[model samples]
Target: MSTVTVTARGVTPDDVRAVARGTARVVVDDDARDAMATSRAIVDRIEADGRPVYGVSTGFGALANTQIAPERRSELQHALIRSHAAGVGAPMPREVVRAMLLLRVRSLALGRSGVRPEVAQSLVDLLNADITPWVPEHGSLGASGDLAPLAHCALVLMGEGWVRSPSGSRTDGGQALAAAGLKPLALAAKEGLALINGTDGMLGMLLLALHDAAHLFTMADVTTALAIEAMLGSDRPFQPELHAIRPHPGQALAAANVHRLLQGSAVMDSHRDDALHAVQDAYSMRCAAQVAGAARDTRDFAAQIAERELRAVVDNPVVLPDGRVESTGNFHGAPLGFAADFLAIAAAEVGAIAERRVDRLLDVTRSRGLPPFLSPDAGVNSGLMIAQYTAAGIVAENRRLASPASVDSLPTSGMQEDHVSMGWAAAVKLRRVLDNLTSILAVELLAGVRGLQLRAPLVPSPAGQAAIAAVGGTPGPDVYLAPAMEHARAVVTSPELRTQIENAVGPLS
Candidate 1:
């Protein structure tokens, strides 16, 4: 596997994708090790001074006032891990667990978390060996740094939890480590807190979501262009001069992408001077760039936030350079929570508008000469009718998912941890929104292809032809529909369709 080295500035979304997808391993930098050692030395000094260092010497949450003796401090770390590994429900996907491991390791590698260098190295070893801990889908309040899910991850390093082996078999953590020719490290003071404290889980999900949005939004533009040409709509709204007056960067980029995709289309030129083409297209087609561009702008903001979180040192009782180990609220998930919530709203809106386009394509009156539902024999076969229904249901679900989780506060930890971020919930829902959107866009693209094929002698642009060709398979009399829809969604999400379009159209924003 390829390896990505971690520095204090942290990893990028691409790095997270590589590690999560199991294509790469992470290596801590030498400077990070030096910093870790420096922080460890400070922790040692604080221990010698007999000061109550929150997680280092005293109890956690409501029990912070209760101090522990040095002899039992290591035990405290182990106990913290065992107790906080209380996540429930279905196990998270391997990729997400792997991302959490990578992010936690990166944060610890920064050396501010007061962990021994060996602890950081152990996380790296686990990731390199491809042993993923079984992290559950629930139990994080998006505060205290994804506590339960991360604790589940930390437990594997101590050889005290179940793990998925490199061979994709389930086994005990100890057995996995033994098979990999490694041994589990004993937890030291503040090590457990370091392991579980960060925005890694939410951040990981956000990174993956951000990556998905970039592709889907681009695909949205491609699919929208196809729909516009198939419906005989004008591309005049996307002129750069018209966009310059309003000057939203994302709007301009999206408009340019659609306008480029529609270039050299005989179908568009056929009606360029036709005075009777309903004056202008509906909001779904005419304003696609505006809605999609706004989503792009929202995505830009979320990306900025994710980048900021990547560089953050999120552990409590962080070790300072001047030998001071002090507790802080760096672990709060509010920033990430808000970003996730905002992106979900954007994804939902994108899907909502895409569904509208699909509805317009299927309507007999609105679809121009195209047969109802894009079916050759409209009365005998209901082509892609229920497909729009499927898209509609998912879009509705996305609407519900878009409701911000950050605004809802639930007191936990005996009210010691009040005003929880619910950021993890926001991330979870955003993922669902994105998944739904993929299917929604797929439906729209499939409808556009069917409509374009029906246009027959009137051909679409080279980019449109490339999109149709990448999706393959001709539109036919009613067939088992799932496979085509699945193929369309896959092609839309992957680079195959985008690459095909860009090859024909030069480049897209």
Candidate 2:
């Protein structure tokens, strides 16, 4: 069953990854439910006690002093969602909407958002039913809390905007609610603000990015292992005892993994392996453990931030239990904006190194006895020549994108949001980096697979051949790389790929 647990405590990055992978359900604890009710009471008390609050009884943003008549408060709340739903352009991807809904519910679940239990449940219901909001792909400053995109998210709950269904079709809010046999929520005070005022958009993208980045981080090891065998490097470098000399956890883990990939390999045999025929190997081939290890460290570092942000409440003018609403800057995206850029930097570096390895594979000089471009018919076929170009293009694009998005900030809301996080830009760029890195790995995989085939009859290390079968090879020769690459991508995301890779390289048998 799909489930997510919300306690007063925090949600971890691993939890977000689990939800993204479709392995769990989302639920709020009784404590959280009770706390939310108390919070609503607090806000109500503050109102009755006649204390001026930021958003509860007052107007928002530039209109803060413009008193909202009691009769117009609900109208204002509903108007806020409808007006903010002014997001333009194509709807956000279904996966992103899932991430958004997950983050929003988690944020509310912290019991700080002063949301009614029913309001929170409505969000949970949407997620469980796979009801994706028609959030536009653009419009957000990462300040004032991802307003536009989030407003669209809230709109679906009120039965206003369109919603994309689980069956891969789009329908009107009313139609979708009817089809699903659900009723539109009649939102109460502070509910719309809670829904639209949070950092869910930027947070959602980061959650998804972190999840995918973790997957690719592991896969990078698989390709690097293949490259290790293709280069026929010394297994001595990966010896567990040798790595214990320095003992960086990442280094040790990588060494152990490569060791597993090289286990019982005829290719690593000094007397039997062709590697001994050469004097030395390329840096990329020899330094695989060090390079990818650092990337893993980066991933671990960023994971810490994402984990904390995943469940924390992040919205303004939070309604409290004593009916006392408080305004604060928890909605600021700076924390996550920095994380997104940092994750992107890590992703770019990994891709850059993979590109280097790909380059070495193509360089006749660096290729160490392999024909130019890993092709026997080098000049006429160009072999993996253009494949390198594609990889190069991807790396170059990431390099440009790696410029820290969080570093650039501009004000909006008439200076109400002066110190922006630029988080949306960071999340989007990181996602782009993820896409490029996948293609680069695919190119590397293709070259490695072909190189092993050329050394066929001799056979690769048992580890290498098994992994090859696990990937199932790209389609036939004429499919052109882009489609083949997309197919390779789908395969990698499958449970079969990871299981196969693990099985093939397990204990290097």
**Top-TM-score candidate index:** 1
What is the C-alpha lDDT profile of model 1 across 92-157, one tens digit per residue?
A: 888888888889888987779888888989998988888889887899998897999999888888
Against the true structure, what is every candidate's RMSD? 1.2, 3.0
TM-score of 2: 0.90
- TM-score per candidate: 0.98, 0.90
Runs in model 1 deviating more than 4 A are 165-169
lDDT of 2 by residue, 111-230 (tens): 787778888888877776667788877787787788888888788888888887666566787777667777899877677888877778788788788778877877777777776666
lDDT of all the models against the reference?
A: 0.89, 0.74
